[model samples]
Target: MPRAWWRQLLSRFDPTPIPDPLWRRALVSCPLARRLDDERQHALRGLSAAFLARKRFHPLAGAVLDERIRLLIAMQACLPALEQGVRCLRGWRELLVYPGEFKVRRSHHDEHSGVVSEAEDVLIGEAWERGPLILSLADVQLDLEQPWDGYNVVVHEMAHKFDMLDGPPDGVPPLPDGINRRDWIVAFQRAYDHLSNDVARGRETLIDPYAAESADEFFAVVSEMHWSQPGLMQRAEPSVAALLTAYYGPSPAPT
Candidate 1:
């Protein structure tokens, strides 16, 4: 049988459905998931079930992991993939949760000098290309408590996953039918440059200055706004906002 068929057959035996009580509890805690329309909410439920079925979750550093918490995480993680379908979640299998912030060491190689410099960076969440999705459980809970704060660790990392689906993240994910690749590149490029300029001038910006770091970060940061503070995104970068709206479907976030 084909790979797709084999996966489908396996899914038939995966016991991943969230019970009604657990689902209701999770929805009550997650404003973003609660705000989704009925149609999309239904899709999210199925996609989340699939996520739980396919991915392995490991709680580290004595982080408390429970069914409710897992369901909550799955719900938010699947939001970005709602329109794209569960297939968008392909190419990853592990979800690592830490109690709080984690530190990761990085080695930067200077291309001209060929000097390797090392540094440690703290992260709330991280998504690796074709690897595990790492997150801080505390940060995930914080996002639930402050859903409209214009930041969402799960969404941000999931955006990176989407961006990396085709290759290394360059701010562009695989476009769906009816979305012009050239148009996406032009609009994203202009928006990214504008934000980069503002950050360089030390001006406060509506979109996160972190987004100005690179095209991929820009896409991921704007994606958080697309779901959390879409009005701000629209005002900051109408073209990019429109593109995100088209790609992610209408914002369930309240204006």
Candidate 2:
């Protein structure tokens, strides 16, 4: 059998249940999860449990991770997967957590000149195509404390994971049966171009300026807005907001 099939089989057999007390504690820490309706809350609980079962968590840089912290992380991580179902989380199984912001050295080769340049970037969160999801534990805690501030490290990284599901991060994930793929591409492209142009001209933009970096970043940034500040997202880009609502179900954040 294929590796994915094997993993699915293992997941089916090992259904680790998140205890009631633990679940309640996690909900207290996670406003977004707490706001979910009874039905969605139940779904989130199951997804969180599955996430704990299938993924490995590593605490680095003196980060202290307890069971409750892990559960809290799982709860937030599973939120994006709620609408897409657990299958959207396929192809990855590790989460690396640092105590705070971390620096990563990256080398980029210029295609034109064939010269390689190396740089170190400080990041709160990052998701690789087929590698671990990395995060700063401090940022994660801050998001839990302030859930409506238009920033969520977990959700932003999760969006990239979903974007990479169909291949590379191209601002689009695998669509369901009824969602029009061409329409998604067109709407997102127009929105991305508009943001890019605004940023190029140094004009004020409602969406994050970082989103103007690329199409994939635009998708991830908008996704953060959808979950953390739905009202702002809708006001800034109603079309993109509507598409995200359709893709990820209704936002659990307060209006």
Candidate 3:
């Protein structure tokens, strides 16, 4: 039978609503969702439903269509943008999920001679400008099954979406009124500098060394740690905690 024209048109704009039972079961099964209370779980479920309904989950070549995989991806993608607003994910719709870590070629200039060199990266997730958000199912599934500290690829990529909202993926986002942008600049700058110095000296640091690369990376790294290790960031760097809280509200404290 030929497809109905109205259905096709409607489906373009309307998202698929997930069933309550399926959603609830997903929360119980995933370790990452374990930290959330009932209320938070409910909110997350709603957000995921809306997200999955609106966005396109395009499995990479040889990928399977599994309920668990889609649920896991949806929940993670929505969590970071939950507080900010659903509009944060607007415009982008496609998601490419790979079976495992994929190779990406990144080209950069050599400082001295401005020679462009290409390097391969085993990436877990990568978001492109006006393109699909790609993820490694293997890596993310393991993370979901066994929760880790301050390293969430889902949140990390979503943070990029937020950072890219205003302009290019710069470290800064349009903060709310209460947060002083200047103060935020000073706080993040000092913190990034400190972390960069520690990484250079080969010393242990709470946040990842990748943060030192750029302001955008710093925001993404700190956003992951801010949610994963909220208490630590709060106690150790009050300014960072305050800034995050202003942007995303109080998140679940790390156990």
- Candidate 2 lDDT by residue in tens digits, 1-255: 223433464467557778899889888889999998887888788778788888999999899999999998888888887767888878999999999999999999999999999999999999999999999999999999999999999999999999999899999899877689998999999999999999999999999999999999999999999999999999998989999999988998998
- Over 4 Å off, model 1: 1-15
Q: Write model 1 residue lDDT over 196-229, tens digit each, in one string.
A: 9999999999999999989999999999999999
TM-score of each: 0.94, 0.94, 0.86
Which 10 consecutive positions of candidate 1 have the poorest summed lDDT? 1-10
If the candidates were sorted by their lDDT against the true structure, best first, what order would they fall in? 2, 1, 3
Quote the lDDT for 133 in model 3: 88
The reply for model 2, stretches above 4 Å from the true place, is: 1-14
Model 3 lDDT tens row, 179-218: 7889989998888888888999999877778988988899
How much does each candidate deviate from the true structure in C-alpha RMSD? 3.6, 4.1, 6.3
Q: What is the lDDT of candidate 1?
A: 0.90
| Per-candidate count of clashing residue pairs (backbone under 3 Å) | 0, 0, 2
